[model samples]
Structure formats: C-alpha cells, structure tokens
Target: MNLYRELAKEQPYFVLSDMQASMGMDAEAKRYMSENIRSEWFLGMILFNTRLLHRAIAKGVVFAAALTRSPDDPPRTKIQFVATREKALELLEQWRAQADGGRG
Candidate 1:
C-alpha cells in the first residue's frame, strides 16, 4: 500500500487471482482492505460474475465493462471482477491511458 501511494501515478488496480483464500482475511487485514485501500481508479477482481447488476446486488456496488461505481468505505471496497490476469492488466492499461490523457 505504501508503494502504491508513493509510486502509482494513475488509479490503483488490485489483481486478485487465485488469491481467493487471501480474501478470507483477518479482521485487521480485512479492515485495511475495506477502508484504507480506496481505489477511485479501478479494482479488477478475478471472479466469475462480471455483470454490474449481479455485483451490485451481491456486493453492493456494480462493475460493468471497464467502468465501476465509486463506493465509499464501509460496505466493501470498490472492485471490478475480471476473468484473468490478462484482462486485469488490460483494465490497468485502460486506466493508465485515461490517466495519461488518452495518449497511446
């Protein structure tokens, strides 16, 4: 998180791959993820459901295509669930380009 705060020029995109186990975090870690790690940029989670409505209904906020709702701390972290790492990185590129004034 320190590195992201210091170096990330664009929005922070967290890649949750086979780390589903990691999601079962303890209170402290879960609190940190839910509160401290606010991603206005995007959060690409590698899960099955990519539909906005489903995510909204199940997780609170919705994620459709490359767009997502910016939810504040409390309910959950704002995350966009992708299918794979490639897709996640693609979303990161999209965010980077957007941050870079749509250059390249």
Candidate 2:
C-alpha cells in the first residue's frame, strides 16, 4: 500500500493509493484512497491519469503533495487517489457554502 501524508497545503484531508496510476478508473481511485487516507476530514479519492501534471495540486512534496507512483508498482510513476490537504480549510469552505446555501 502507498502512503500519502497530507492532501493539501492548508487542508487536513489526505489521500493514499496502492496503484501507480488511476487513468480515470474508479476502482483504482477507491483503492488508492482506501490505502493512504487515514483522517476524519478526508474525502474520497480524485482518480486521474498523470501524476507529473497533477503534482502541483499536492504542492511539490510527494509525501506532502501526492503519492506519485505506487509502492506496489515502482516502475510506474503514476498516482491514483486525491483528497483535501487541509481539514480547517475544507470545513471552513464547506461551512461558507452551506451558509450561502447553494443548490445542485
């Protein structure tokens, strides 16, 4: 299993993954999120294709940003899961939205 410490720079939520890459697959996304994320504020995984492009979302640090390449598969340099980086930031934003009372 892969270990991703934090999800964002100011958020508390984090993501984890067992697969090296998501490639837009839902199952891989789930696996990655299930393996790494271990926080209460953490949300579900954001499965994507490439890590090199999405690395910025994590803020540069592999452990800090996102887990590039899976621990299960070293040859591959892809990421599978994604979530919030900060808990306070997420809660505050969510709270604000709720207060605003937007609808789907």
C-alpha RMSD in Å of predicted model 2 compared with the true structure: 14.4
- For all candidates in order, the CA lDDT equals 0.48, 0.41
For residues 1-104, what per-residue lDDT tens digits would candidate 1 score against the true structure?
56655544565454444344444557686545444443443343434324554344324323232144334432323355676567767776775586578887
Best by lDDT: 1
Least accurate 10 contiguous residues by lDDT in model 2 = 73-82
Best by TM-score: 1
Task: Tell me the spans in candidate 2 whose CA falls farther than 4 Å from its real position.
Answer: 1-4, 8-23, 41-94, 97-104
Tens-digit lDDT string for candidate 2 (1-104): 23244334344332343224544567676556545543333333333333654545332333432355446733312233334335434544554465458651
